[model samples]
Target: MYLFLVLSLHTLWVAVSIAMQHGHYDMCKTQTKSDEGIVWEYMACQPESRDMTPYLKVKLEPPNSTCGDPPEPFCAMGNPYMCNNECDASTKELAHPPELMFDSEGRNPSTFWQSVTWKNYPAPLQINVTLSWGKTIELTQNIAITFESGRPEKMILEKSLDYGLTWQPYQFYAADCLDAFRMEPKSVKDLTSSTVLDIICTEEYSTGYATHTKTISFEIKDRFAIFAGPRLHNMASLYSQLDTTKNLRDFFTVTDLRIRLLKPATGATFVDERNLERYFYAISDIKIHGRCKCNLHANSCTFTNNRLACDCEHNTTGQDCERCKKNYQGQAWSPGSYLTIPKGTANICVSSMPSNCYCYGHSNRCTYIEVVNTAVCVGCRHNTHGQQCEKCKKGFHRNGSAKLDDVNVCIANICDNELLRCQNGGVCHNNMRCLCPSGYTGILCEKQKCEDTGSCSSKSGQESVSHNLYLITMIIVTRLCTF
Candidate 1:
């Protein structure tokens, strides 16, 4: 019986492990058979979601927002008579430091980060709590801020995409949304597929002060449910939408978050100016769940040198695998796609080859040049020539309105020093046309102004004679040099 039970347990563990990796992109490439024998088949991938609080750096604005700088006393919100709590920066046990907000909580008396009391009543006791990751991350779960004191009556949760260069509101919390932010309150459930990106103010977490109700949240899963179904069982549908929509994908991406504490919870309609110590902010914990934004080109992220970065794959590089590696620019770089379900498109960058060249479909043959140690496209079609047939040959210019692969991308020059040479002392202007002299006319200045009206004077005749002499001398010199 013991041996049978152990076998069953081992089987169950394997099943559980498989389930855990079901939809998560834990593999970046797999070996597969092809015409060239065994080869690697890459696929779009991303890291698994995890608790991100431990990887963040927290900062408090106003520089001295945390309490206990000068040792202060504070009363409880429920009972003003209980004035036993003290905050002293010098004493570790009595001090309420910022790090306590992220510390593990299960102690008999939970540790917390507390702000100074609202001593100056009628003036707002404001604080800004900023959390930075120094890298882009995509939200995978709700952001919960557990307040040791009563939930703040007015606060704004903001996010930054460009590393704190700018910020936009993620959510607003207040007892009266209209009064605080001039907007009607709406819950995440009210959002739909068409309005999933709307930023709304919520009054749900800022109501009457209930002792058990201390957590305020910004709902991320609820917004995702607008497309992924209520239980998130239709993740393929969600992934499809994210793959096609750029704005929707960026909605969950952030580099930093800031909690703007505009007003503390004043239980009553009016503040009790007589006992202002009862009004202050205290937070016990903050929870953030996310994954590093790897542009779907990596399956793992690592923390190094006090910073988080994605372990890039598919011949890609950068903090987020945002560009193709050097020598792998045979094609323009593109982010991996989540379409085609299950194993999405890898969009892998192709390496530059010394033979069997890649010339953007403009050339089929190439020469292995020894000097450059690279392939040069030979006899490129479409009037294109270069190492990779990416440039227009001489006497031709690129058509700005045409794509690089289009045959019309390289148009013949209206005037050039070769076959289409400008005459009558005209010069080529940007290779588009000839800037003719005052006495010249026609596209290439081949016709004189007097010839247009059929008026030939002695002076015009003399000019024509000189022009013929010049052409003959050039032809004689060209023949002698050729021989």
Candidate 2:
């Protein structure tokens, strides 16, 4: 609900005339992109009321102009178009145009105002302006730029956090009209007189072209100035940033702002003479959101240069400091970050996943210990050991030392060195089992179970030996008996 006003440069010709006729620049349109990246342009947003008055300072002087009688009071040569002109019916007096780019009323009715000319200038004209808050402020995830000129050829934005000494390309929000078309708000006011319509219709303007019949059909299309892009006579364009690593608050604190106009609107030579050769450019407004002011007290957020920064605890990071940091993976939820969803809003939701420690082939297993910031891998597998289950365990040898990413490389010894194989011709299997011989069995086949003896000689010699033994045995027995 909080809106921070930045720059407002209502640049459209019709809006300029309306602002000139009226006292304020309320005729200009404004664009607002929600957190979901859906753009909403208030054709009658009248954001001049929210102009960033205090911080705006015109760094370069634009062409000068004066308001005089006879709206087209004939002026001789040498004195070119006055910036802004208005005549008083009562006193026949002409008033000076307002400083900054806001003074838009001009004498030429066909063209909005006599534009600053650069036809014969030595180089291309560039408009440079700076915005500052007098103190630093936290930035949001995106910056929205609105233009009034409707048809400026080119514009580039840059930012400097260190007071203009250095600058980097500030990313423009990427946009698409495809999905955004269905999400356009229906309750918006008509955009027939809108600056965006002017840009759309004028794209194809030519010298002899008469009227544009496409306006009627474009108006009936139920289009939104913000949600659809201006396709000559169609809808407003969509804008967003995809795959952008840097968010609006990534800068943390911004002290200065700058906008450079590389290409501007050149007078359409095809248009009536009143608008011929008059080149100009104008920006309607800018809006940016930042870190919540309440974060300083409740969330321990730090305050710098009138801005608040969330005091993100280690292993946690986000705008509200509610999400876990990378590696310390976890999905975090906090009421502080998002309070409630607004009605009628369309959002591309991203689902959250629970955080867990990750490990490869276990040098160690991951164990989630409460109160510890990082999970520890405890029981390593594959004979590996380390905080991340990466290194080899003490007694294990690593295979292919050259492969750094190989996780299952560690090898362990399965048997004692003395028993590398079964001893005494035993067969070893699985580094532990030893197959022994038929008559030998032991841990290493070292103990013998049976003894081997030899057999007798020839058959005849065996028979003679048998008879002699029998006689000798009988004689010995008889002698023992007699004794």
Candidate 3:
């Protein structure tokens, strides 16, 4: 089996075929996650080294047509693509760390590697990818990512929601639905680590497949390192754009590294420093699997500096906005964009990162961007500002840099008596206090909470500001419960 990691950072269209794909499956394991948004994670997965072609082809075809005219596209099953132990260790050195890498000093001690085969139905097209190896393999399950490339043409993805029994057309994260998607081979934690991913594809109804796989994405990283030799480590963080309307495309780059043992410092007893020179390697691959709605060739999107972007004027995903469906932004969805992580990996077995909050230093403010589900962002309770909800919101005309934070503003009405409600979201001034709405927060809850802050108008001059606030507060409270 051959392994290839593809990361698209620039120039979207690309196709590469190399003879030497030998990599690894090896020895130790380390994984770590921090409270900060940044995390250092490491793991080792072992492969079963068993032939998975039979099960790989194991498919659950869609049910009989339920409607008079099902739709514009359809899917069909064909012969299985066989994997007759194509793995060769001789070329395995290719699997070794590249001459230049970082973090990991060119040593991958994991177990087996996994392979992926994609057939675009009827029988004319196919794409195959391989998985890298590490010290201690960590996953054991069927996995696959629903990704596609080629210029911005209206591309469609489909998948079987019921474990491949029936298929459905997929709509991307909604950013014109042309961005890529993926799924890693999944395996039961206690189950055997040796397993292959199962994916069903069809060119006849590719449009349908695109839809079917709408809810899928592959591992951005796993146990293997595509770039070796001087490669290795656990450090990756997620960051979005300041504006929702920018272009972004994935890109991967390997770096060179050098490790040296240290010897203890004279004054700092515990701080040790030594002498040992080791090479480091890294492999960064960006793969584009979601087809483009533009119908242009695949390599059109790419990244510049560190930003992903697309070729289209407003083509949400690709080089300019290759991250179409859901490009990360300080604000959730300034334009039309949104998304989520897979439910399959929600448990500790996988992991869940905290929702981002725009609260800094207890900025008691509450604001929601378009589709910025509250569940995805955790904010300060009393007062705070900025992301992380750590600052105080503007309230009751309070001025001076001495901003109120986690302040006991709204005692009974909206704060849940937690002494810290409406931090940076927005607020309602009442009885020498601020009735902070879950939405409106900040010091005074004056920052129109939602993307489009509702006008807190007093009912046609009836002094119903209190009443209007009552309605808005109720509306906001109910919304939070549902999430």
Using TM-score, give the best candidate's number: 1
Q: lDDT value for candidate 2? A: 0.37
Number of clashing pairs per prediction, in order:
0, 31, 208
lDDT of 1 by residue, 5-97 (tens): 999999987864553323466668999999999999998889999999999999999889888999999998778768888989999989899
Once fitted onto the true fold, the runs of candidate 3 whose alpha carbons sit more than 4 angstroms away are 1-21, 24-48, 52-162, 166-358, 361-379, 383-386, 390-483
Candidate 3: deviation at residue 482, Å?
Answer: 26
Which candidate leads in lDDT? 1
- TM-score against truth, every candidate: 0.75, 0.32, 0.19
Candidate 2 structure quality by residue, lDDT tens digits, 190-238: 3442332221221221111112211101131222223333432221121
For model 1, where is the 10-residue window of minimal lDDT? 15-24
The TM-score, computed over Cα atoms with residue i paired to residue i, of candidate 2 is 0.32
Ranked by TM-score, the better of candidates 1 and 2 is: 1
